[model samples]
Target: MKWLHQILFLLLLASAAASCKKFLNVEPADRTGSNSFWKTRQDVEAAVINCYGFLFQKFNDFNSPVIPAVGDMRCGGIGGSIASGQLGQGFYTLSQNDLSNTTNLGVPERYHLNDIDDWGPYFESIANCNITLAEIEKMTTLTDTEKKQYITEVKFVRAFTYFYICRLYGDVPFYTQPYDKTPRPRTSFITIFNTLIAELDAVKDDLPWTATNPSDLGVRACRGSVYTLIAQMNMWLAGFDKANQSKYWKDAAEKCVAVKNSGAFELLPIEETKRIFKGKTKESIFEFELNRNYGNTSLYVNLGQWMTHSPIVDYGGNSDLYFVRPLMERIYPPNLPDKRRDTWFYLPYSNNQTFMFLKQINVADPTGYWSFEDNLMVFRYADVLLLGAEALANLGSNNTEAISMLNTVRTRAGTPLFTAGAEDLKDAVFWERQKELIGEGHRWYDFVRTGRVTDPNQIITPMTQDQFDRGAWTWPIDAKARQNNPEIVLNLYWIR
Candidate 1:
């Protein structure tokens, strides 16, 4: 139970921590904690699992590890009622682009990283990874093969941590050594990204295709997940790495090829979209597993019931906040009747025929008692294919091939095909991604990576192309992230 104790101690430390920046600087519970630990494979396994747990396992808290609200809430796909006087001001400020008034200070009600809700947990998870990697090598209970697998897996997690952090806050404090008490300087976004991609590339060969163990399927990194991340990391850079945009786009296209041919995953048909997040699907490349009988502290799985409710419906959904009717109609076009339109949501004729997310509902447990049992998808084949389509179109890899990939997802949805120039094909793919990945927590990053957010859209924040190009699209490094580390430099343009 030492690992459980470690888990408790880390959670308590995270909750008790004061500022976002300082939140990441986690210290061990006892002087002997690390030295006495990492002596066996179980120790290493437990440690790595805790890294995943602390983020994915959480209930109602401002800092819950479901994808940060600032990422999507600001971009669109939701309509929130004002929670309290000034409590929900930040979200409105973000949504309405009320840039002149800068008087908000919490995390959930206010979707800014300038608050600690997101920054702390991400860094803490990274800290867990640092500790696991630093000591797993010292264990004598495992074979050389085990050592190689464990190290490679944790490195993927670490790189993903940095990658996730960079997408939200731009640049952050980078650390590789765990339990190092020194206050490290915050690294720049560019350097952090370059380092992350380089690290993933270096560890690529070492990580396995899938867990050789039967219990680890779809959850662990396979060459599929590794290359998919490479494709995604490069895509993130394509928009921001101005000087090398072409090179990065090409890299994303080439990297995704391995996942495509790995024979490990396939796109699920629209009829099978219901099975996409059910855990252990051929469609899921990486996901966090949960079972209703067991507690994982994940509250996100309850979203489907909440996002679609009204007095007329019996599923207990919170219908007030949901896909704006006009926008849903605009993007999906009820006339098109795409499978995602027909299947992912329901039109409650009783509630003026409003749209509700029906994707995660367990019909057998209509009251939503088993809602938490669903898996949280991190990466899947649909996303990977879209990544390939986007990158290939951008770099001129082959418009014909890009269209084919784009059409694959379309074929599943029974939507139209792409027959346009490369640039047009790129736009077509972005539009497809928006429709397909909605509510899965990917839109905001897509907006940032592509540098465009329109009003009368889910992302009501009216940002100019200039503002986005200058990194104004990202959140501020809040007081917590800077409180203890004077070494931290703020992204000044974000300051009101």
Candidate 2:
């Protein structure tokens, strides 16, 4: 499966370049669309494969915390390599609680990730999805089921990408057909959410519970994958919309139930964490598939390479990023014996100031440094259970069901079970997620949704409920992106 991933990665760039057509009004630059060319099933698959490249560019092209910046680091519990030299200061500054003045972070010698907009990559991905959806319907060679499957898969990925955009940017460019619209104002979040839920409902059953091959586990959309995302979206909507908490909470819980009934996933025990992050397991619902050697190009494991520099077997090297030891030790649920603390990180220092995350440390190269085979987990059963717990808590008191969900996730991780009431149970669920999904990129959103995002250092100020409500939690659109599209305006709070 990892080897198949290598093939998929190669297709992402090579086949996509030759097959994908003009999209998003960029002068049809790389488009090579023709009826005869796109006549086969391979053409449609190639187009879908092309969409993955944009996401890979954001993560593997460089060691950008593009994923973490908007997800984990902003949660204010981050600290970076205090190594002899400042190898990764950009991440350090971001973790230290400053994303506004990235100049202060100092440009790295290599992998200079410009101010956090990186919107172009996400939009480019969206455009590809749009192109695939628009053209795949017209093909006469495929059966109705194949046609529906292709359309639903593309639509699901687009919705998934847009879901992330809306969370970080609040509003964004939304389109179904590529090159059909002009540069427009950002679409409202409510409109996008309503559209996504409807689209997911229409096609959720159309997807299989699992793919025939191991490589397609999360890389390709399945019934479990689609429902999990649908469930996750409703959970966010409950937090963002606020007024219809009961509606969204119910929707979220129902979707989670759909995934559970599918019987496609399970909670892997702590001792088997290698299978969890190596991905394509009973525990994994969706993961970003990547391999060490994808031919020709060196494409090393970016996550492990950037995070650490330690030369330990099944671990990382040049360990650059870490959690502030004392605060995390304080917050990681005392006396609970959470095994993740050991599997996910190591305390090799006497001062105990840093703890390196070891989830992606299994593979290594000839030099004995961590290699690129580890698959990044996006959604797993544990996440679903925790979200279910969170949604159940929102339903009100006397929710034995919700408390059981919390206990299920906790017990698997070798942590204490929840014996508390509804309110306390909700708080336990929230903190449990913080420990469980720490570096996998869900913390910041969880913090913002629960109104618990604050400066653990006390130096960086917290956004008030008023500011959070006003859509002020989003990142400023980078200047370069604004220069490219005149219709794109700035997030007002960031305007000087």
True-vs-predicted CA distance for residue 56, candidate 2, Å: 3.0
Q: Tens-digit lDDT track for model 1 on 276-392?
A: 666677788777666544433343434453455543245443453566666577568766658887888776222232557766654324344323445666788889889898888
Model 2 vs truth, CA RMSD: 5.9
- Candidate with maximal lDDT: 2
RMSD of each: 6.0, 5.9
Error of 2 at 297 (Å): 9.8
| lDDT (CA) per prediction | 0.64, 0.66
- The candidate that wins on TM-score is 2
